[model samples]
Target: MPESLKKEIGQFNVFYIDYDNHDKGYCQSYRRRGFYKISLLEGETKLFYADKTMTFKRYALLFSNPNIPYSWELTGNNHTSFFCVFTEEFIRQFGMIKTYAVFKPGSYPLFELSEEQFRAFKDIFLAMQREIASDFLYKYDVLRTKVLDLIHAALRLQPVGKLPNKEANSALRITSLFTELLERQFPIESTLQQMELRRPAEFANHLSIHVNHLNHSLKEVTGRTTSQLIADRIIREARSLLQHTEWNIAEVAWCLGFEEASNFITFFKGREKLSPKSYRNSKIE
Candidate 1:
């Protein structure tokens, strides 16, 4: 067992991996208790992740945030890798880990690296090895910054998408991220998990931008205000739930964050021109 894996329970842990130790390495993924992991592998493997499945060869970067379940199945002979696991509390300065495209579900978190890029990343991991092993003061602080560098650099490498309008401008980019965050929350997989960030301000808070700024960016890029966008999504989700699931109207309302079933009914009627029950009944009929 690696020392870092057994090290004193704390907010931060870092180490290069030994592939044979499957329990302690990045080779397996599941819903972690609280920590987030970032890893780089040097060989081929099949990735089974919550949002998608993929296979990678040569060099790959893998990111695992809490609640985003993932696992790895080795396919090639070599499985050398380095990874670090740390809690959100470990780096007080950094938040919005979710906003990073790499950590978001349904986005490609694993990237095959070119030889040159692979060496560059390997260098970063090597530095992490040296830093964590050293007795230097403020080593954790230094390590945190290095990890941030690794994360942001990887994010910059993600191929640009059309929706974010990277070609348009900064505001448009922010708007795109906001839209994606909203979309990722649903089709509401089960009635058990309640929806969050159902309001514009919640999203603005998550994006670390002012609500007005978020609304302005969204309005400019989408021609719809932030509230409008959120409402549209909620209505879309509500419609899907009503039309498909056998859950009662109250249950559907609860999943979408409505406090009372009547409130859900009024909201649905105003938007869809039919009550939730009526809509569901229509679908059934």
Candidate 2:
């Protein structure tokens, strides 16, 4: 397959590409490090990411962090598009306050644009290009403003799905905080430590809440007990490491707080119906 849209690092490692060349099997196949892209074209294409394939239409916005792998397949060649790329630090220094929050790990990041909104975005890109070419002193600032303007416009036009109700939202907020904490201490290495951290009573004590109340809140909001959620998160992390890294079963188990490899094997088989190696090989094929 011809690699049409090769990667190029722009300002602060942001990737930029303008695909004009066409080959029979040309497609964009690569990953970005904290990248956001807005497509300004009327052409239809398929975007594959996060294990889902979706048809991308005119004026669509796609974003990915450093953690995800993504690729694109071009079905048609008649299109003109402009893209702006920048790193997380570049945006932090230049972007508005809430820009990072809007794209945080749990935040929904995809958006599709309306015709009018698309026109405005195209104008912003054009302006950015002109500014880049000139000897402007505050060109970076101009770019930052345009980027924020684009984000604000999208927020107004796009719906980030439904947030929970007020009470549910409050409960979910606590649950999210707890989940983040648990994930930070992941890959349980020893059963003793897992007991120390994964026990619902201990977690409730650390959060300064009664155990029963904590259980009730977490169950109501996430439909799972606190321990179940923790176990699931650990398993998910194990799967990621097994699939993406060349770690052996013993090492994987040790990293996840398992003292013995046998327990890890049993856990993997119980949840996945296959050993870690089998699952990994199946995915690659």
**Prediction 1 TM-score vs. true:** 0.51
Model 2: lDDT equals: 0.60
| Local distance difference test, each candidate | 0.74, 0.60
Tens-place lDDT digits, model 2, residues 189-234: 4433342365687778888888887777677654568877767766
lDDT value, candidate 1, whole model: 0.74
Please write out the lDDT profile of model 1 over residues 113-200, one tens digit for every residue. 8888889888888898898788765677788888888898798675322233333355645766786788678758787978888888
What are the runs in model 2 whose C-alpha is more than 4 Å off?
Answer: 1-20, 24-41, 94-102, 159-285
User: What TM-score does model 2 achieve against the real structure?
Assistant: 0.48
Candidate 1: give the clashing pairs. Answer: none
Candidate 1 root-mean-square deviation in Å: 13.8
Q: What are the clashing pairs of model 2?
A: 187-256, 187-257, 188-256, 188-257, 189-257
Top of the candidates by TM-score: 1
